[model samples]
Target: MTYQNPKNLASIKEISARLDDPNLVILDCTSTVIPADSGSGFAVADGRGAFEAGHIPGAQFVDLERDLSTPSDHLLFTLPSAEQFGNALNRLGIGAESRVILYSTGQPGWAARVWLMLRAFGFENAAVLNGGWKAWTNAGLPVETGAAKARPAASKPFSWTYRPGFFVASDEVVARTEDEALVNALGADSFRGEAPIAYGRPGRIPGSVNVPTSSLVDPDTGLYLSQQQIEKIFADAGVKPDAPLIAYCGAGVAASNVVFARTLSGAGTRSVVYDGSLLDWSSDPDRPLVTG
Candidate 1:
């Protein structure tokens, strides 16, 4: 098998030139954090509102909670059925040969989540837009207002043929964490129990090391860290090259960032994202959470 680096990320300039490519499909996955009434954790910002206001030309808006996730009474953005996800993409005109480019206006992690979702489902042509919306607007690229028309969903039911080894579970967290490095992709504050921000509980899973995905991107540029820089960040977090690593975060979104970064760093083959993350762990009071 051939190796591909930066497998989940792409730059605006690169995608800009290929906007007219028939095989290309671009999606906007912008989402922000909001406050909850109970003050338990957090809520997601309205991606539809943001997309309606402005977006890359010809880019259809994809909702993390709606288009990409399943309807659940308890969870917020759990992964949708493979058929559900495929139909959503099918409606966007994505096909067997389509090269998907995903972006976001807020955190790059949001875009990464979609990229990871597509990747886990055996789709290899998907990638997150580097620097996302901020970089696009800052670069003076054309931004359009209002919604773009989407292609109709396929008449045939989208079948789900899952590709394993892309995700990890809570029980697996306990079973394999000793042998594999568990990286918590949340912020350092949460790592220290100072700001558990979003979750039913306050703290983190036992044996998980903190490697906040935010550290791997430039705040001003919104671009990912360089290879050298990514190496240092992982090193500081006790992550090693060629090691088996599982990334997790609040509700499993930010973990995508780490997963993508690992791919860029040549360790992706042994990396996986814990899909349920803190949302699943924090639910069971029995799950151990340690604070600094």
Candidate 2:
């Protein structure tokens, strides 16, 4: 089956042409933990507030927490129910045949979560917008401000469905901790003996590769590197696209980033995510924690 271009954002000119099509639905995925005044490290910054302030004319707001994801200390954006997903799209005015173009406020990290979830749920027409809000606004495109009332269609067609991924259960993770091939997408500090920010346990999945998902994007451009660059990045991190790779981060958010990238690589290779990731594994006293 032909999946949507994993590198959709690389060609800005081509993607821009589809913006005006009637069958398309653009989503402003900018999300932040704190406002500008608070001086947080990095945040999507009032995503809904920003949407209300200004956004692409036809774009809709997909709140990461409230709308697209479920609340859980073990994981963020753990795929919602198919019915819930269908309702979300319908409420956002997304149609069955609509091509979803997701963009963020210069940060593709958070937005990538939605892109992966939508695709995993069998919505193949979805793609992430390149350069995110910065690209659109920089091009001097038409922008709309203020909240638009949802025009609930009397009978909206619901076609979104969830296709279970090969995600490994925490028990499997615990069992395979000594595999020496599991890849930890979290920070280096966590991979070592040092304690991590999100979990009580310090080390990583035994012998796991370390390639923080944040490294996938160009810091300045907010765009993913080319295919060659992606392959090289993974290779340097000891991640072989051909291997039976397992990706995990503090929660599953970062691991999803790697899944999106590897799927785009198209090498007939597959990687599974440890959905609970470190969150569930670390909290349990029985799960082994390895330190360098």
Candidate 3:
């Protein structure tokens, strides 16, 4: 049976049934967080160790920091150039016809991060695995150990089409007009400058409303809430239904989760992720941040 492309989120059952489809490409996009030696904030580490230990059968691993992000002296996961991203996809054997499934070990944010990256690069056939690795294991799905077998190169190099507006920089965020809604995806504590961990500075972009990524998912299942529930969360948070949205978190990773949930709730066309997010925003003393 042929694999059917999911709109944006796929379930474990959907993937388990398509294990034999040649056109299917499953990616483990896990990245773990470690406490920085300074002991103030956190640092990110590649999940190669976790992936090497075990992962979904036939799933290759994609290191968000090393494989997908552009190397930057100051930034963490800045989006790479179109050509660079295209080359990476080609190396993964992702072709125009491939249906990609992305999942992470912990939060779905890691998977959503890659999903947004794929969409920004104009690849529309990718989907995030709902509930991710945890849900899969809970269901007793088959898993494999050790490194992934090298993927066969795509028949032709991936043709990249850059889609503007899916990812925006700090300048666009700074230039946001009154009509635009700036949404913070960080937890309420961080947003309110009460968290022990601060990204440069606690607090959020001035005038941004909170729609914490945590609120978008079921605490027990690790799966996203129903579409109606998500939409209500947005509305309750004062997110305008029709206004353009700029989503951000400490860095850009969690913001992708918010963007993904918003999209799933039928309000994604007007949403964009601030790629640099608060990491860039808070670095500049000149940029204003508001605390409650």
At residue 168, give the lDDT of candidate 3.
Answer: 92
Span of 10 residues, lowest total lDDT, candidate 1 = 151-160
Q: Write the per-residue lDDT of candidate 3 for residues 1-292, one digit (tens) a residue.
A: 1122238888889999999887899999999878677756788889988898999998998888888888876678889888888888787889978999999987788999999999998898899898998899999999899999888987655679788979999899989999898999989988998877778877888989999988988888888888778888999998877878999998799999998988887774489999878878888999998898
> What ranges in model 3 sit over 4 Å off?
1-6
What do the candidate models score in CA lDDT, each in turn? 0.80, 0.68, 0.86
| Predicted candidate 2 versus true structure: per-residue lDDT over 1-292, tens digit per residue | 1233554443456556766676767787766644234332222334888788888777778887678766665455566787887788787767766667888784475666777777667777777776677777778877789985564452446477777664667766656533324778766776785632535567786667787776776777766766677778888987665666778876666786677666666532557778777767777877787887
TM-score of each: 0.93, 0.82, 0.95
Clashes in each model (backbone N, CA, C under 3 Å)? 0, 4, 0
| Alpha-carbon lDDT of model 1 | 0.80
Model 1 per-residue lDDT tens digits across residues 12-83: 888889877877778988778886777668877658887888888889888888788887655667777888
Q: Where is the poorest 10-residue window by lDDT in model 2?
A: 35-44
